[model samples]
Target: MTKKIVVLGVSGSGKSLIGKNIAEKLGYRFFDGDDFHSTANVEKMSQGIPLTDDDRKDWLAALNKLLIDNPTAVIACSGLKPEYRAMLRQGLDDVAMVYLKGSIDTIWERHQKRDDHYFKGRGMLESQFATLIEPTEEEAFVIDIAQDADAVLNQALSLLSES
Candidate 1:
């Protein structure tokens, strides 16, 4: 069966990059969840304001639609909170979540180097870390982001194989 994968993490955890690579390897379609966000959501995030659950309702619904539309696909999204992850999983039978786990410092360092992005600097990173509810082993195929991209991808692929 074709796998439906969600590459999930905080900003700067390399979800977009990693998800695209995984999709390419697996011959599945790839989507960046940021592209699904409404302009208002982007504006709020661009101003370094953290999104409330209400703000994410439409966005999450849109992502859910994407998941439904493409059964064999890899999507990059910040499924930070448990509720968020649960929402994503709703109505899906064979979805595999790849949580890109990373420390605040590591994420912040990467965020600083990013020249073009909606999510801003340290404050936004801190908010994301605070909001995140780390997924358990049963909930996701967790991969540490301290490793290089290729290593992370290999580990994720290995875990997905077992799952």
Candidate 2:
């Protein structure tokens, strides 16, 4: 079966990095969910404005299409809420989610160092965490992000193998 893997977490949690690595290791295509965002949504986030569910509907739909287009792919996305995840899983039968779990402080530190991303500063990170509805262990392979990137990737690979 084709495996569609979503690397999910709050901003600065290493979703893009780890997801890309996972895709390389698995020989699958990699996609950043941020690239699926509409121009309006990007503009709002660029201005440090948090997006409402309505603002996210189109972006989520686009991500879902990406999944459909690349069945065996690794996608980096902030699948922060259950409903958001459900939207991504609309028609997929073999989807696996890897939640890059991390403490707020750790993620905040990383966020502070990032200069190129639109997800700006501690406030945006706080908003992301606030909106997050963490997935249960049964629902995802949760890998802690405190470790080095390679270590975290290894853990994710190990968990995916088991599943």
Candidate 3:
């Protein structure tokens, strides 16, 4: 079994929910990467600001350390860029990535129903999509999220088993 897993997607793509489910099913610790963000980052996002690479440098390092500290855990993170994913994987060879894939319209609809999140607005979502560098098949299990969340979770679990 892969001991370390990161659920990757833009906001509103269900990374947190799916990551939690994966951790529960695997009997592993769950960490929401959002909780590890700096106060400044959170503040910026609350104001509808898109974070740059430099803004994420320290955040990624902290998440990498979290992975190092907890050998068996699942994390929810945006990981929009390849370099960001690389940073998250630093010093971790057994890490697995599960990307929740969905169309903007689909995710936007879902985002509308969500509540109390720092990240908001269609523009923010668009910025996230613009920043996204999707992982290759070899790099992550890509689960289509146009289906129901339950189906998406089932598919992710099934893929993990196969891999």
* CA lDDT scores, all candidates in order: 0.90, 0.90, 0.92
Each candidate structure's TM-score, on Cα atoms with residue i matched to residue i, is: 0.97, 0.96, 0.97
Give a tens-digit lDDT track for model 3, residues 1-163.
Answer: 7889999999999999999998999999999999999999999999989999999999999999989999698999999988999999998898989999889999999999988999978999999999998988888999889888899889988888776
> Where is model 1 more than 4 Å wrong at Cα?
none
lDDT per residue (tens digit) for residues 17-44 in model 2 = 9999999998999999999888898889
lDDT by residue for model 1 over 1-163, one digit each (tens)? 3379999999999999999999998899998999999999999999999999999988888887788888588989999988998888789888899999999999888888889898986898899888899999888988999999999999988888787
**Top lDDT: which candidate number?**
3
- Native-vs-model 3 lDDT? 0.92
| All candidates in order of TM-score, best leading | 3, 1, 2
> Ten consecutive residues with minimal summed lDDT in candidate 2?
116-125
TM-score of candidate 2 relative to the true fold = 0.96
C-alpha RMSD (angstroms) for model 1 = 1.0
